[model samples]
Target chain A: MPTINVTLYGDIAQYGSGKQLATLDLDLPQDANIGLLLERIRLPSEERGYLFVNSVLHDVPGLNASHNDPLKDGDHVGIFSISHMWPYQYRQGIHLSDTLKAALEEKGVMKNTYRE
Target chain B: MARKILRIKMDDLSYKYEEVPSKWAKWGGRGLTSNIVAEEVDPTCHPLGPNNKLVIAPGWVSGTPAAPSSGRTSFGGKSPLTGGIKESNSGGTSSQKIAKLGLAAIILEGMPKDSKWYVLVITKDGVKFEEANDLLGKGMYEVDEILWKKYPNKPAIIGIGMVGEKKLSNAGISVNDPENKPGRYAGRGGLGAVMGARGVKAIVVDDTGGPGVEIANMDLFKTGRKKLTDAITSHDLTKPGGGLNSYGTNVLMNIINEAGGLPTRNFSAGYFEGASKISGEMIAETVEKRGGGMTGHGCHTGCIIKCSNIYPDEDGNDLVSPVEYETAMSLGSNCGIDDLDYIAKMTYQCDDLGLDTIEAGNTIAVYMDSGALEFGDKEGALSLFDEIRQMTPLGRILGQGVKATAEAFGVFRVPTIKGQSMPAYEPRAIKGIGVTYATTPMGADHTAGYTIAPEIAGVGGKVDPLSDEGKSELSLTFQAATAFIDSTGYCLFIAFPILDIPEGWAGMAESVAGVTGQSITGDDVISIGKEILKVERDFNTRAGFTAADDRPPEFMRYEKLPPHNEVWTVSDKALDEVFAWVNS
Candidate 1:
C-alpha cells in the first residue's frame, strides 16, 4: 500500500471529513486510480467536482468505466467541488500544448487527457 | 436612424442634441466615454470643477438582443479620486433603456453655480429638468423608491446617494438593478461627485414608446447572437452549475485563499483563518437556511451568468442584493470581520452612503491600523458607518478615500496604486495581478485587467501566481481585451467563456460587426482595445501622470505577504513596457 497527500478547496471542504489540507494515509493497493481515491474519501455521489492530480486537472470519467491512471507514491491530489468554478478552463481536462503535456508527464504525473 | 447625443450644459442649465461625430461613430461604452472626455474636457482641470465633463454611454449592443450579457453602461470623467482619467462601468436596465431611446451618450458639462437640486426626466417625448431639492440628502434606495413610485411606469433611475451630494472623492453613481433596487453602481473614481457638481440628482429614462436598437445586418446579428448564446450557455464557467452561476464570483474566496493570495486585515496577512465563514459556499448555505435570499440573481436583463445574489438576514428579510467577491473580501476577512451578516450590513451601508466598498474597506482597515479601533471590532466597524452617515469631521476624511485616511493617521502601509485603493487580492502573493495593479491606467482597478483569470482561476491559461515570468504580456493583453469588452456592452463575466472558446470571441466580433455594419474582425478588437487605452493614457499623461504613478505603493514592494512570504518584485522596466506599444 502507498500513501498520498490530498487537499480539498471551495465547498469540498465541508465534505473533507472536517479537514481541508490533511495527510490522509489511505490503505490502497498499487495502481489505484482517482476512482478508488474518490470512493475512499466518501464524497457524496450527487455532488459534482473537479480533480487535480499533482497540479494537473483531470476530467471526471463516465460511471461505467474508471479513468484509473496508475497513481504513484507521494502524488499530490486536489479535490474541489463544482461549486468552485474551475478557473483554468484552458486546461479544463487537459493541456493542449504537446510541450506542456510532455513536461507534465515527465514529472511522473498524468496529463488531464485520460477520460471515459 | 441616427442616434443622438444629449448634451447638458450645466453652467446655463440648457441642453441640446448633437449628431454623433464620424470619428466617434465606431465607439461605444468605454471607447466612447474615453474619447469624449479626452477630446472635450481639460485633462488638467479639477475633476469636480466646471471644466470637467461627464459622459455616460452604453455599449454598442446594449439595447440589442445580440448578446445575452450586453447591458453594461460606462461613466467616464477626470477622476477626483485617482486624479487621472477614469471610466467606471456598471450593469443595470438603465443602459438598455437609454440605448433604446436612440441616444449614444448623455454628456454633462460645466458646473452649477447654485445648490438648487434638479432631476432630468428623459422620456420618449423629450428631456425635462425638474426641481429635486426635496430629494437631496436621501439614501439612494429611498430616492429610487420614491422616484420609481412617482413615475409608476418603472422608469430606470440613475442617481447618487448622500455621499455624492457631499462631494466625497470615493462616491459612486448608483443605477437601479432588474428588481428596481438601486444596487448596481459605476462605483469607482468619483464620478458621482462629478454628477453632483452638475446639480443633477437623477435621470429617469423611460423607453416605452421608443424605437429599439438599429441593426445593419439582422441575419448576421442573429447568427452571431446564437453563437454567443451557445458559447455562454455551454461553457463550464458561464453555464448553469458552473462556478459563477453556482457560487457567484465569491467562490473565488477559497481558490484565492488556497492559492495563498487572499488579502486579510489590510493586506497584513495573505491567509485568513476566518475566510471560510464568508465563502460563497457559506453564503449560499446561509441564504438557503434563511430563505428570502436568492443565489443566482442577474443585475440586468439577458445576463445569463447570474453571478449576483440576494443576502437575507436571520429572519429572512433582504439585507443586500449582490454581495460581490471584492466587497466580500474587502469588508470581510480584509477587515478582520468574519461575520457574513455583518459584512452584508456594511455592504448595504456603502451602497446607501454612495461610497465605494473597496475604498471604504481599506479606509476602515487604516483606521484600525491607526489604533482608532481594534481589528474585528464589530461595534467599532459599525460605528464608522454611523459616523459617515452623520458626516462628522473624521467621517468626512474617511469618506475622501484610502489615501486621505492613510495620510490622516500617517500610516505607511497604504495599499494603493495611483491614489485609488487596492481591491481584495494581495499584490505580493499574486505577482501577475500586482503587475496589473501597477500598470493599468485605471489605477489599481482589478477589472481593468483581470490576470487573476489565468494566475489564480486558470481561466484563459495557467500562470504561476507567484512568478513574474510572462505577466507583463498577460496584463497588457487582458487590459486591451477588457477595454474592447467594456465597449461592447457585454458583461465582463462573458470573458470566462470567450477567453478559451475561440468561437465565443468570433461571436463577439460578429455581433459588433452585425450591429454596426463595420465588419469587425478579432484583430480589429485588439486594435480598438489598444486605442481606448492609449486615449486614456494620453489624457492621464496630459493630467501630469508619469511612469512613477504606474507602480503600486512603496509598501507592496517592501512588505512580504505571509503564506508565500513574497514581496512584489516586478521590474519597473516591464511596467513601463505595458504601454510602449501605444507609442509604437
Candidate 2:
C-alpha cells in the first residue's frame, strides 16, 4: 500500500483541511494515476487547476506528468485550482482531463485551450 | 489634444513647453522616459548631479478607458542605487492627471545651485513655482495633505519624503492615491534621490478643465477595450472572488511557501514556518473583522482587478491602504516576523518616511545578520524607523539601501544584485525568476520580468520553478512582454490573464493601436518591448555595467536554500544568452 502525501491549495483546500498534509493511504495499485488520488481526496473530477508532483509544475516543459497523467509511488502531489491556471492556460500545451476541459467550457472560464 | 513636453530647468528655475519630437511621438511612460534619458542624458553622468535628468511620463492608455489597470506612471533616471538605467513604475491618480494635462513627458533637468525647495504646480493655465520651504523635511503624508489643501481642486501630487530630501539612495517617490493617501510609490533605484537633487519637493498636476487622452479610433478602442475587460473579468485569477481580488497579491504567501521558495530570513531559507500567519487568507479574514479595512480597493481609477487592500488596526482605524505582498513578505517573513500588525506598522512607517519598503526590509535583515538583534526582533526593526527619522550615522547608512548597509558593516550574505535589494521571491529555490533577477537591467527588481507568474503561479505556463532548463528563453520572453506592458501603463497584474488568453493579449495590442492609430499588431508590441530593452541596455552598457554586473549575489550561487536545498545552478553561458533574441 504505497501512500501519496497530497497538499491542496486555494479552493481545493475545501476538500481537505490543508493545515496538514492529507495522508492518502488508499493502498492503490503500482504506478496509480493522479485521477485515482484526486478521487480519493473527494476533489471533483471536473476541477481544473495545476498539480505539481514535487516542486515541478506538472506536465509543463514536457518535464512531468499532469493531473490526468500517472503518478509514481511515494510521490508528493500538490493541487492548485483552476483559478491558478488563468494566466497560463496549462503551460506548454498540456492535455487536460476531459472532465476539466468540459467544465472549463461549461463554466465559461475559457475555451479549454493552450497557446503554442 | 496635442501632446507637449514640459521641461523644467532647475539651474535658473525656467520652464518651457516644446513640441513632442517625432521619434518620441509613439512613446509614452517607460518608453518615452528611457528613450529621452538614453538619447539626451549622459549615462556616465553623476546620477544625483546636474547632468542627470529625472523623466516622468504617463502610460499611453492613461486618461483613456483603454484597459482596467492602465494608469501606471513611469519614473526614469540614471539610478543612484543601481548605477544603471532605471524605470520605476507605479499606479496612482497622478499618471491619469499627467496624461489628461496633455503632456507626453514632464522632464526635470539641471540641478539647482541653491538649497531652497520648491513645488512645481501644473494647470491648464501655466506652471507655478511655489516656495515649498515650509513643507521641506516633512513626510509624504503631511506634504500631500498640505498640497491637496492648497490646491483644493483634487490635484495629483508626486512628492518625496524626508528620506528623499536627505538624498538617500533608498528613497522613493510617493504618489497620491484616489483616497489622497501618499501610499502608491514609484519605489526603486534611488530615483527619488535624483528628484531630491533637483530641489523640487513635489510636482502637483491639476487636470481640471484639461484635454484628456486623444483616441484616434473610437470604434477600435471600444472593441479592443471590451475584449480586454471580458478577459479580465472572465479569468479565474483576476475575476471577482479570484485569488488577487479576494486575498490581494499577498495571496502568494501560502502557495509560494508550499512551493518552498518564500525567501525567509534574508534568503537563508526558502520557506517560512509563520508564512500562514502573514498569508493572504489571514489578511482577508482580519480585514473582514476590522470595520475600517476594505479589500478589492483599486489604487488608481479604471482598475477592474482591484488587487489593493486597506489594512486596519485592532480599533478598526486605517493603518495602511494596500499592505502589499512584497512589503509583507520582506518585512514579515524575510525578517522572521509573523505578526501582520507589526508588518502593517512597518509598512506605514516606510510609506510615511518615503522609503522603499523592500530596501528597508532587506537592510534590516542584513543588520540582523550582523548580530545586532535577533532575526525576529519586531521591536528592534520598528526602532530603526525612529533612527531613520533622527538621521543617526547608522540610520543614514541603512537609509542608503541594503548594499550600503552590508558594505558599511562588512556583513556577508547581502542578498542584492546591482546594488538593489531582492524582492519577496528567493532566487535559489526559484531558478527562472533568479535568471530574471540577474538579467533584467532594473537590478533585482521582480516586476522587471515576473517569471514567477508562469514558473510558480502558472500564468503563461508552468516552467519548473526549481530548474534551469528552458529558463533563458522564458525569462527573455517575459522581459520583452513586460517592457511593452509597462510602457502601456497597465498594471503588471494584468499579465496573468493576458498571458493565458490570446484574445486578452491581442486586445491589449489593439487598444494601443486604437489610441495612437499606429496599426500595432501583437508582434509589433514585442518589437516595441525589445526596442525599449535595447535602449535601456545600451544606456547601462555606456554607464559601465558589464556581464559581471548581470548576476545574483555570490552567496546565492554557492548557498543552498533549505527545505528545497537547491542552489542557483543557472550557468553564465545561459544567462549571457538571455539578450540574444532582443534584436530578432
**Local accuracy by lDDT, each model:** 0.78, 0.79
lDDT by residue (B351-374, candidate 2, tens digit) is 888899999998899888888878
Error of 2 at B72 (Å): 0.3
True contacts kept of each: 0.11, 0.10
User: Which regions of candidate 1 fall more than 4 Å away from where they truly are?
Assistant: A1-39, A42-78, A86-116, B450-467
All candidates: TM-score of chain A: 0.61, 0.55
User: In terms of TM-score, how similar is model 1 to the real structure?
Assistant: 0.89
Off by over 4 Å in 2: A1-41, A45-81, A85-116, B450-467, B580-584
Q: Cα deviation of B514 in candidate 1 (Å)?
A: 0.8
DockQ of each: 0.16, 0.15
Worst lDDT 10-window in candidate 1 chain B: B451-460
